[model samples]
Target: MENIWEVSPLHRQVKSEGEMTDLYKIEIRDLARAFCGALFLALPLHYTMEMWARARAIPSFMLVVILVAAYLLNVGYCYYSNFKGRPARQVPWLDALESLGVGIVASTITLLLIDQVNAHMSFDVIMSCIALESVPTSFGASLAKSQLSAGNKEDDLTDGWATDKKKILACLLGGLMFAFNVGATAEPIVIATSINYGQLIGIVVFSLLVSYLMVFMTAFEKEKEDEGAVMGPQWAETLICYSVSLLASAALLFMFGYLTPTTPHNLAIPWVVVLGYATTLGGSAGRLII
Candidate 1:
């Protein structure tokens, strides 16, 4: 016969209540971190007019794509780079989903607090804006383990020569973060510089060169001991990383309205290259720290 105390309705009820309480506490802590992280990285775009306009103009289908991309990025960061202690392969899907939700919720709350969202705005406008902003916010939330945790070391000794895909994804996330922080301010600077065709070409060359040096030749602490052991030829790895940063730059330029479908190919190419300069630095820095 089972023990009366173990099988008792009152005891089971008490155990269930205790479990629920602990779960609530964990959730509350996660919420606090998510809000703080999201706000830290997202504050600039929260107030920018370009972001608001893009939010309205972005189609619903693209918005869904953004959310899905953000989710995958966050999951990759959370699972591979940030939560190193936990076996990411075994991590439940729900936790990743919750972090994504946290990003959206935190962005919504911050926008509301800043008076960006109000009853005066159409529901579609508000939702679209929140979804657009959530990309960076969610990425930041995904990085909470690295950014928000106490005494979290930036370098991981166990991070051997990571697979090319992981390294590229890290570069993309870092570049995106850097771009989100500066893309809004870049338009004015780009316009003011009046960068001519020659200068634009030079900028592209310079960005690629700098990106290569930063990753391979810099005096910065080594990220991987077997850095020279990448699967492909050295130039191939460099090109892959450079391409990721360039792609990130283009995406950010589009999101910030610096590039549009109507823009001529020749004109748009330079701006993307120029922005890639800053974004590559960010990507390299991200690889170092993350």
Candidate 2:
């Protein structure tokens, strides 16, 4: 009767009443940590390799239109899904792995696949940032869900529908993170192309991650999960996250392009220094400041 997508009853007992207030706080805290790790790893470890993905252009005009509709629709859907009293499930895998996969895919799409749309950005980098950002977010949100429960197994089956109002809101937030990121990243790429044909297969993967997060968060807790609405992390943590990203961007400038095959004059040079210095200012740094 148990499924991989459903969190076991044991895991639900992991948190106590005092934790309810921390649901949101935990989510924001983890988010900052994950992004920071990504920046530190991505900045210096693989910029040139990311740049090498020239996959070619394709028809994407229609696709662009669809994505725009989806972005708006999904944001609304996030709100709708929760209030509707839809079914919920649990899933395996820590939130970090989810985040890492997203970061890699976004990097790939931005560095290589976007060219498929005639070199136009079907989305803005912000969108990809959204997609990657949402991965672990679902897991973070779920902590709240799992910690708070409706009380007793006897009524959980039918009455659970009542929780939809709040659950749906959380779903919308998670979905918005994915849809916005996908559209935003693809927007710039799609604009360059006349048509918005299917994006590289990655969008599906991203969607799956988002969907998983919603159910995973819903079922992961045991004690009548509702903790996120209670507590929130300090803004200071958000600042640290942005700061780490800035440092990562600088590191990225130096580590990448050292081995590119471009011609001698065409090879990257002092541009690295300028980029190293410039990227830090507005890059992840801004995320922290805000």
* Best-performing candidate as measured by lDDT: 1
Write candidate 1's Cα lDDT for 66-170 as tens digits.
788777767666654442222322142444566677778988988899888999999999999899888887767666656777524432323554566557766
Query: Which tens-of-lDDT digit does each residue in 1-290 have in candidate 2?
Result: 43312443422422323443233443444345434434433333123322222111212342344334334433332222211111332111233243434344534544354342233554644344334333323222222222222323331232344433333333333333322222222232333233222432233233333333322334434344332332223233223322332333322322222223352432232222223223323222222111
Query: Positional deviation of 48 in candidate 2, in angstroms?
Result: 13
Per-model TM-score, in order, reads: 0.78, 0.23
**What TM-score would you give candidate 2 relative to the actual structure?**
0.23
Model 2 residue-pair collision total: 51
Root-mean-square deviation of every model: 6.4, 19.3
Flag regions of model 2 displaced more than 4 Å: 1-93, 103-250, 254-269, 283-287
Query: By summed lDDT, which 10 consecutive residues of candidate 1 come out lowest?
Result: 83-92
Positional deviation of residue 279's Cα in model 2 after best superposition, in angstroms:
1.7
